[model samples]
Target: MLTRTAIYEGTIRDGREEEFFRRVREELEPLWRRFPGVTAVRVQRMQARDEDARPIAMILEMDFPDQATIDACLASPIRPESHAATVEVMKLFDGRFYHLVGAATVLAPAA
Candidate 1:
């Protein structure tokens, strides 16, 4: 199994945080789920960090069977639609994509 993690690093623009999160929950999430070859999608909102200066606002974990699938999904037409949905929320963000990496640990859920 391969996991692709994308960290959307940025702080929500002033006065737009709530709207951004609301759209993520109401709109963007469904679009993310529609991406081809996406086996699983996990969305996380950053709450606290060791450093107060950290600007990361959200982290998204998308799992695929391989890098090829990940690449294909990015190239798919749905990707642009999903990206457009994200852009609606991104108007509230001040940063950019931080990283994209394959997972080093594949952990099983605790029983």
Candidate 2:
């Protein structure tokens, strides 16, 4: 499986955190899920970090079966729609795409 992760690595614009998350939950999520070959979607809101670390406002993860599926989804018409939806909430963020990788580990719960 291949995962495309968009790490929203920044701070929320002044006084816009709640509105941002709300828009993401209500508007952007639906559009994000509309992409083809999207197996799973997750959004993470960052709570804390190190003193010198870049504050990550959010993290979005989309899983696909392979690279081709991800590429196709990126090329699809829905991508523009997704981008538009993103802009609505993007006013609350001030970061960039952190990284895109093919391998990741899932940690199991400790007994």
Which candidate has the top score in TM-score? 2
lDDT of model 1, residue 21:
89
Worst-scoring 10-residue span by lDDT in model 1:
97-106
lDDT of 2 by residue, 31-111 (tens): 888999999998988877889987778889999998889889989999998888787678677776564857577899998
The CA lDDT of each predicted structure is: 0.83, 0.84
| Quality of model 1 by C-alpha lDDT | 0.83
Q: State candidate 2's TM-score.
A: 0.86
lDDT of 1 at 76: 94
Relative to the true structure, candidate 1 has a C-alpha RMSD (angstroms) of: 2.7
> What lDDT score is found at residue 95 in candidate 2?
70
What residue pairs clash in candidate 2, if any at all?
Answer: none
Q: How many residue pairs clash in each candidate?
A: 1, 0
